[model samples]
Target chain A: MRYEEFKEGIRDGIPICLGYISVSVAFGMTAVLSGIPVWAAVLISLTNVTSAGQFAGINLLVAQGTYLELALTTLIINIRYFLMSLSVSQKVEENMGMGKRLATAFGITDEIFAVSMQRKKRLSAPYMAGLILTPVLGWTGGTLIGATATSLMPPILSASLGIALYGMFIAIIIPPARIHRSVLYAVLLAVAASCCFYYLPGLKKLSGGWSIIIITVAVSALMAWKFPVSPEDEEDE
Target chain B: MEQIRIGYLLGGIAVMAAVTYIIRMLPMAIFRKKIDNVFIQSFLYYVPYTVLGAMTFPAIFYSTQSVPPAAAGCAAAVVLAYRGKGLLIVAVGAAAAVFAVQLLMNIIIV
Candidate 1:
């Protein structure tokens, strides 16, 4: 049973691997373009497995930003994953120990958490191992392809494909937004809050990391206040 | 351009990986018991959508060369995603739309 569940996790990770390739290709190109070593680029993907945080870290590194700044920026940008894991932690198999839980948490990217949460029961070790395996392979593998293929890749192609990662982001939210009016409203609120943070004369000076923190927390808080989802509303992801 | 010092680069990655990993690990490892708090549950439930949205818009609008192609790509994604296409298909659709528009725009400019 555990093996089957593990296999299912790997099976579900297929599309995510594809999406990771498209996005990580851009990151690989960006890292090399920024003059980062290919090994470092791949290492970032291997260790971090985060898109926004890696991008932000790379940008800061290129600009020779302070170490404190870089770390804080990464923390803030990847903060959402904390929430993701918190939710997933609740759903982790009760028998699972701290070690295995930590191992599973290492794999808790946004998509992984979402799919795992959709499971009807507490997540099992085999299932999580299977789920995380392909995407980890995909993430590092894509980075390798990107970092090495730097010379052959056309600038235009890389730029055009940059949209693919964002496209995946669209895939995540749109269905929920469409099916749930509250989600739609939360999305709109997030966008509106983001725009204000971007454009408002006084607020515009806030850094990207800080703004993301604000937008995520504020919009979620407001939605929770106004919408107040019942236990069932939050059911099955 | 001056390159980032090698030590700093490694340190930065370590910091990022450590912090990001810790942030993820702490919750998953420590939260052995379930939270019965309603507000926190509701708040956590909405966090994913809000974060995705906060990342997408405004950022997506400028991800490409200009608004026209980027808009084309995003519109394709939104439409296809709304229609329930798989993520892989949606991403391909968006990238292809942007590529097509960019090609035409290049031709027009030249």
Candidate 2:
């Protein structure tokens, strides 16, 4: 029974694995473009299976920002995982022990969480493990390829690839923004705030790490208060 | 290779990995019940979108080392994504747009 569940999880995870490889390739390319070594980029993906958080973290690394900045930015960018962990915790078997819970928790990404939550039965440790396995491997392996291959690519090609991350970011937020007024407001406000941090006199001095943290926290907080998601809207996701 | 300290890069990666792990782990190990606070729930719900949005703009404009190519890419992405194209499509479309614009600019310059 456990093996069956595990196989099912792996089957469900294949599409997510494919998507992850593409995104992580961009990540690897971006890291190398920013002067990070190829091996280091792959290591980051291996250790941290996150997209935005790693992107923000590497930006901090390149800028030689303070450790405090790196930790806080990663924390803020990844805070949504906490909610997913909590929500997914409920769907897991009630008797699930702390050890298994901890192990599965490490794999709770936005995509994994979405897929697992859609399951009709309680999630088991093996299932979560299987679901996480391919995506993790794909992400790390894609990073390896991207980082190594980037040096061989022409400057024009690499330069164009640089826009791929932002393009993916747009793709993530746009659909939610279309369906929800609150999300739309939050995104616009974030963009405006982000621009101010870059172009405004006093704010321009803030490093990219700190600027992202402040804008994300302030904009999200304000939007949450002004337009708390209706329960119905939450169900749509 | 000597441009950056390997120790420094490892330290930064460690911090990121640790923080991300703890966030994912803490909630699952401790919370058996759903968070009932509407404000907190809503805040968490919107956090990812805000972070992605903030990270993308202005920064994206500088992505290709020039505003025109980046802007063209961003516009292409926005249009395709708004039309409900999948992530791979939007990303590749934007990159293609940037490449085309850069090629055009190169032609005009030479």
Candidate 3:
């Protein structure tokens, strides 16, 4: 890759890397508290790059959660990435190969996808590489730091750090909500649906894994079908 | 016991990695051609938000044992987020609120 392009990639990825640092630190702290080894937590942050699923998974592991439980839960949690990947694939430069595509896909978090989608041109491989790499490092590094420091930190402090993931989520949902009425609607609908799931009898008993997947798919799909992105905008992308 | 648990953790990671890679990579690998259909494109575009909403919403309230405090905190978060407060502020605020409320409730009830 050209030096200029490489530099540009780093420049573009700054926000994502910064966000990862905070969120990953929280994940790491939680992992340590959950009785996972520091290295194991780091490995999870490095490999998974998913906050919610990792948090849920760690809790389950501590409880001696079954394999089926873990599998089902994580699957439901990460089901969104599948859809994100599908949309992001469209942004991949047409000439990009399978290996490049796969590598880029690894970095396809909500934040990265949002930023990449806003870019003017099709995302370059070097740009995507830069976007994914720093976040991976930050997440892994943060987890390692949190794990090692868990002993030094008090329980209240550790519990407080758990909020960082939610903070990140809030950060994600707010930006679009501010600009678009549709996004606001989407957030409200999601929140309302979630409450229903919690209150309803049979639904409450459903596994956390499946509940998230089903709710997200149903609500988001309904909205999308109702208010599809205009053809003109699609052409612009 | 520790060794067996460690084995399970590692095994879980391996399995997770494999499944995640496949789900992530399969679409790009299989569909090399441009997706020109409007309906399909729209479906793909909306799917992520749906999935994310589903994933995040339930966790906000039900993940914890006590519903009221967690729910209150999450509700505060949603309102703050709606108002365009920064994410860090909302998160820290909500969590602190939950922790405090729960602590107070415990003290009062006991």
Candidate 4:
């Protein structure tokens, strides 16, 4: 076990935790505004670390969306994690046991996946724990602060901080898109696809959760076909 | 019972957590062997970028009090991040940009 890897993983996760805390703070405010109790709001963040899925789930709960609707909506929104987990699994050392693997899987958010993928070695249990620890706490911790301090938090500050999570994501993707043509293509195609879903009335009627699923899968497949990664790029796995 | 009720809320969160965990768990547990397929590997590689792209668009534009302020924040993130700033700096800068624009807009509108 490389204590070095674990330390490095913690360092890498700090930014993610910062990003997560701010957004989950926004979510915390949202839950409070929606009449969700503070404890329940924190519970949601603790159990489900996903940004979109929790937002959608809370919206559904607020609007009285059926259980089937809740389940199906989250299922679609979280499908991206499956792809991430698969890619991450290829990197994880095979000697890892099932119980440890499950714990690691619980923590596989988009930021974690991105940071983990950049590692040029087999992902280890300790490294993943290091990666997972801060973000998980940041997410739940932010929610706690947000939920408990709604009256104290200025509306404008909470509102502004809401976009920080997406900012982190933009920061993550834009660098690669700027440097790589295929990545740029994938990014553009995804935007176009998302716009269509948003603007077209027939499609506009579809939920945001559904739009993400269709656009992500289709654009990823097209980019994969159009620009298959070279051997050198796949070296870490 | 309505979803807003405590019982429903608990049930809903449990179900959502279960679904999310299963989605994340099954792939790692099932795909034990090294996957050699080029197409699949590429597809997985592109998944993160594409997903982030789709989620960011249109939504980020509407995430704040109004579109212009949100746009300013996103632009700040893009510009700062393009210049290779740290993630904390980029995110904080974006939020500060949005807050500043929002403050200015309130001054103008009032």
In terms of DockQ, the best-performing candidate is: 1
Cα error of candidate 1 at position A175, Å? 2.0
List candidate 4 segments past 4 Å from native: A62-66, B1-9
Higher-ranked by TM-score: 1 or 3: 1
Docking class of 4: medium
Check candidate 2 and list the clashing pairs.
none
Alpha carbon lDDT at B44, candidate 2: 66
| Per-residue alpha-carbon lDDT of candidate 4 for residues B8-108, written as tens digits (9 for 90 to 100) | 88998899999999999998899888778898888888888888888889788998999999999999999998998867788889999999999999999
Q: How big a share of the true inter-chain contacts is recovered in candidate 2?
A: 0.80
lDDT (C-alpha, whole model) for all candidates: 0.83, 0.83, 0.69, 0.86
With a 3 Å backbone cut-off (N, CA, C), the pairs that clash in candidate 4 are: none
What TM-score does chain B alone reach in each candidate, compared with the true chain B? 0.85, 0.76, 0.73, 0.87
Docking class of 3: acceptable
For candidate 4, report its TM-score. 0.90
Off by over 4 Å in 3: A1-35, A55-73, A118-121, A152-161, A174-180, A234-237, B5-9, B52-110
Provide the lDDT at B12 for model 3: 76
Candidate 3 B-chain TM-score: 0.73
Runs off by more than 4 Å, candidate 1: A59-66, A114-122, B1-9
lDDT of 1 by residue, A189-219 (tens): 8988888887789998887767887888888
By DockQ, is 1 or 3 better? Answer: 1
Best by the lDDT measure: 4
Cα lDDT, model 3, residue B9 = 86
